[model samples]
Target: MLEYVKTILQKVSFNAYLFERELKKGMRYLMPTELEEFKDWCYATFGMSHQPILNRYFRPAY
Candidate 1:
């Protein structure tokens, strides 16, 4: 899990916009609830707020 996270972080480069966009794209195959839970987990683990991150990069209807 740590290695997976490290790989994601390495790919996203700490840029919240890019990270949010990539996460959204990557999670598209998941159920909505699962995606929400995943987002929450990411927020807790990475010390980032979900709203701000999502709001910054994810447009509505996505």
Candidate 2:
């Protein structure tokens, strides 16, 4: 799961620090539209529940 996130970040040239900061800020959960699309993509590609991994990577803004 972490590996998948790392690969995506690497592909996008996202810095580790920046990625961690964004995740800490709850960027993924805050952006429901994008999150939904990402979930769909993960489901189609990996055939697994993305919520578990997503919860690990991104916390709710609240």
lDDT (10s digit) by residue, model 2, range 1-62: 43455456435333445544543444343355566555445446433423444456545569
Q: List where candidate 1 sits over 4 angstroms from the true fold.
A: 1-10, 49-51, 55-62
Candidate 1 lDDT, tens digit per residue, 1-62? 33454357447846777776666565655565565555556556665444566544334564
Q: Distance (Å) between predicted and true CA of 30, model 1? A: 1.4
Q: Which 10 residues in a row give candidate 1 its minimum summed lDDT?
A: 1-10
Cα deviation of 26, candidate 1, in Å: 2.0
The C-alpha TM-scores of every prediction are 0.47, 0.32
How many clashing residue pairs are found in candidate 2? Answer: 0
- Clashing residue pairs found in predicted model 1: none
Residue 38 displacement in candidate 2 (angstroms) = 0.6
